[model samples]
Target: MKSPLLAIMLALSAAFPAVADVLKIKKDAPKQYVVKKGDTLWDISGIYLDEPWLWPELWQMNPQIDNPHLIYPGDALALIYDADGNPRLVINKAYRKLSPQGRITPKGTNAITTLPLEMIKPYISYEQAIDSDDIKDMPYVLGANENTKTQTLGHILYVKGDLKVHKAYAIYHEGEPYTDLETGEVLATRASYVGMARAFRTGDEQNGVPSSLRVESVKREIQQGDFLMPAMQGQLLPAYFNIHRPDNAVSGHVIASPRQVREFSTMDVVVLNLGRDQLIEPGHVLDLERQSPTVIDGPRGPRYPEDSSKFEKLLSDASQLFGDESDEENTTWTMPKEKVGELIVFKVYDKVSYALITKNQHPIRIGDIAVIH
Candidate 1:
């Protein structure tokens, strides 16, 4: 007889026929595998299914698992079949033990993530998109110790603005402005990260005094007139999240990249025009496509005056075969857009969001179109 948990999984599998049909297993998938350090959920899922983004469906079928999103290192995953022969991936169960509270807990180290955190942690912790109005009021570096123009780690600086005593802050230099390709409207400006500092003394506006601060670290040289904002603390991001297509139809373009490169590929962080206003959020996956250039189908070579009449006669004959002479002269052909890559949105602002490229067939450009998969 099947166990109660297995029976429940089999029943759930029967209920969702469409999901079972779509969740296809790879022919060469292993019967069992162990989670290891540095292994991501996407990498693990790709080993079992063709569409790795459908990983959540596997856990949905087996509701007995505890915290399906928190799979940790050393845990064992087994590929099992239900009564109807539909494959399901489940924790070995033997690797988990009941605690004093009677809760199943996997014996392992830190939980695995959906993507490599190191690649995106800097962008999350240090950088941000801000409105143009906000930049006007932010505190800026008034002067540095020793009367220098630039300051580095361990240098003292004076800031002219509102600041609290012993508060941590991140230094930033205003970068390029993101704009809408269609309307030419400015969306948001990027606050490029410079370094970090801690306020030692608060400034008094009545006395015309500037706050005293000491630089703690530097990624770039902190110069006079650079701005400061509260430093982000702790790992506020989720350890694991599922990838899925957006529910509503959405389309946008890659407007910018933090690295400021012309072409992007897998693992590169990119900025997209779609954001909270468009209902775009973290874990939403979008497909990339490159539009083809239009080409003229008319004459390829120059015509001499001697052959002008002959060429005109030939053009007239061709126009008669195709359409009007004016129409033929203006006709241009464009090829279908080519599918390039995929990206997953991880950070969102008001009118823009940041996405990490997850896959690519060709190099993705700045103006490439992103649409719902």
Candidate 2:
């Protein structure tokens, strides 16, 4: 019979694997390192770990320090092992010395972000996905005060809808609709942000009076019939969060590319078919795979032969090879999908979510598959 302490240890080992497989520290990882300006958590983790997304597991939080997760510039990190020989990273508080005034100050005021803010700042602040049913009820531009076809910054525009006084709104234009390829369902429509506007006077719907709004900024010329949505206020971006694989087996396809490019690479924002309904949340890392095309094995004729008769004969032979299954089971076979890259989910909607490509070994296409890493 096993003792109670031994049974508990067995249970823990079965539940949570060792740091060697989960954390997997790199062979060339430094014993001690200093934090620097413009350094992100992902980049720092890559310096010490083979899988940077597993940084949260390798970090050992010190309860004595305030906000231990917030690592600032000049702070030193030391890689140490516990009694069980499990690797962990901890902050070296003794790295800095007291100043002449007997006070210790950090080199930088701001804490390092989880990912580069410059890459996803615009998408988080300006870009939005709206449902198709809600678009018709949204406030739209009626006209401009200057009687021009298009409006710019400092131009007053008239909007017809329920508007609150002293409220800021983002001007947007309708873009392409995102659809689920498997389910044949329209998830959401992409909103093209054009400018920012502030409402000074409220509109009276009973009197048919339009509200007055002043355009404060413009990325593009604000045209008539542009939609209006509430501007994000005091929205905090994700700075420090636990990175982990999806709890369940979640898989989806890349539905839309915001950059309007055929192929996308690292740092490019792409929309996935999975969302909150599918239990997808921010900070979840996913692996990307590109499906291989099916190849047909048949008798080869000529390379780009101009003779029409030769081409016909080749086509007939290919069809006969495909139809005849007496000797072989099938003439065509699909190759295995190749793993291309990885992406991290940052923003999620109801049926669709926005993810930034973090690692790209190959150019990701529109229909690439994203599965839990």
Candidate 3:
């Protein structure tokens, strides 16, 4: 059997056809595009190609840019091909260098953030996983605009906790409760949708006490007792990445789904049970699997191998039919797990990673096992 690495390479070959069969470039795509501030890799790729994920296939990195992937505003990208005749996009700028105290001052921070941070901001930043013990310590809504209990967009929210003024936070309402299937332990209730608030004032040592925040926006009701967590905008990174199979085979599970739903479809995000500690990282492709079915042992009422037709075989069949329980009655039958889909890890945390369903043969749902493909 071909190793996953080999398989991935073969897939790229199959995906890349002749020069004429290369991924279609957007008709409106500029032959040369200047990297702009606020531009995401995903957005940039989409601007130039029909399928953005295939950017790596056609991205021709210019060695001089320090890191070709780190394109900055004012940097130019042009479509070109190497002597091998494969089409690619490269940064269209002359290679330049800088000394610690060089005449050319270091340009402003041009480091590219991978993902469109705004899109996943709510998931990575505001969404809080809390336990019952955490309730007291977490920042909670004390009240809203005008000392009255209600809150709305642009309304001031007074929260009781140590919150820094002018910092953004996500408001969360306690969500549906989940019980551990095995331990029967009731995990903390889900942190539900509430809204976003940016703290503009926090009580000082004497005059001011509670922190004050302005309601930026909300998905659900922005009310009292809502939880607040630091907006983790940095968690989101470049979404457009080259896909690779893990070097080692490892198995894990889909622990959660978008909106914490049990079922999900393609393009939905999935929380995985594996993370960096397990050698899992962004771009790793994992195959979704299901547990083999468990089968029950039936009564042994004189059953034997079908080939037992002759007298000699009949004797053996009789002996087998009468076999008594020796872990025999408890023996289980099962089939290999079904591969339902394929997912690529997009973001990885400490104990969990987020993966996006890239391909599915069946509806991808929770609890399906995921192993490095």
Candidate 4:
């Protein structure tokens, strides 16, 4: 038989097992947390770090916390003091919400917008796909000036082409790719925008041929599985047709190719192959590069002494008599120089976008590479 004191001691020893696992973690409790429903473990981490990018770091330390994506209600986030007494994120159940903020509150949020699809399709340049037999059989068309823009591409414009009746084709604006500095990634290019064609041959000769075409509806609000087919050749700016992407993408492939301002007409739009999908947001800055003319010495030879020959004497006479630097400057400045233009990405999309040439510092043209900053 055990003594009364021994019995009491044994009972306390049995209870110690439960008490030890209870975890006195008052020092390891999180200081603050905003209540939100359907918030994941990654989402909470983003809020604490003030950087959504640090979610991966928290996952690295906690292995028992499986499924980094799930975080249920009443989840506790504790801050533990390390050996150096530095506070860090250490999970503990003791850290609970005193009063849960329920749903039906617009406490913290913003108006949300979904990403736009790539409205434009890709075009296979002659260099890409060659129809060997049809060498001169280029896709071309002529249309009456139904331009919406009094000067620029506005509301709607239609071109007539030599397309077969009831034949479906695609229109594409071959654009350039952009880069993302945050991820060091290359974004895809936007190609042709497709629209159904209700082809009709009026047999009306506008410029000596019976090639007249009417393009019906145009492509917009793009999705996957969209492609481009041959359409009547006509000049068009793809920008006027669709809403620009919300953000300007700063990421693009490194482009050093020299481009010139081909279309000098005012209100001319230069199209690019970057959009919302590239992480291009509005108000992004793009730099344009201009190619300087190469200086070439034309007919350089030893000039006779100033007083010896008429040519030398004439030169000396002109320099002393005129005293104008105009001739000397004109000789160097006369070379043809290629100029480039830059603009801010005011509009964006998943794959296609448009920009405005800011301040008209330099004239922008087709084929000019817009490097995002």
Q: All predictions: root-mean-square deviation over Cα?
A: 6.9, 7.1, 11.5, 19.9
lDDT of 3 by residue, 121-234 (tens): 556554544566666678888887676666778888887887887889878787654444334454444566577889887765355478889999978667678878776533
Off by over 4 Å in 1: 1-22, 63-69, 93-109, 233-235, 298-325, 328-331
Off by over 4 Å in 3: 1-136, 146-150, 176-193, 204-208, 232-237, 296-331
Worst 10 residues of 4 by lDDT: 110-119
lDDT of each: 0.75, 0.74, 0.62, 0.37
Q: Which segments of model 4 are wrong by more than 4 Å?
A: 1-54, 61-64, 70-97, 102-171, 174-373
- Top-lDDT structure, candidate number: 1
Clashes of 1: 0
List the lowest-lDDT window of 10 residues for candidate 2.
Answer: 1-10
Predicted candidate 4 versus true structure: per-residue lDDT over 163-208, tens digit per residue: 4655544444333444343453444443444453444443433665
TM-scores of the candidates are 0.80, 0.81, 0.57, 0.26
List model 1 lDDT by residue over 295-314, tens digit each.
Answer: 44446533333444555556
Candidate 1 clashing pairs?
Answer: none
Least accurate 10 contiguous residues by lDDT in model 1: 1-10
Top candidate, metric TM-score: 2
Q: Pairing residues by index, what is the TM-score of model 1?
A: 0.80
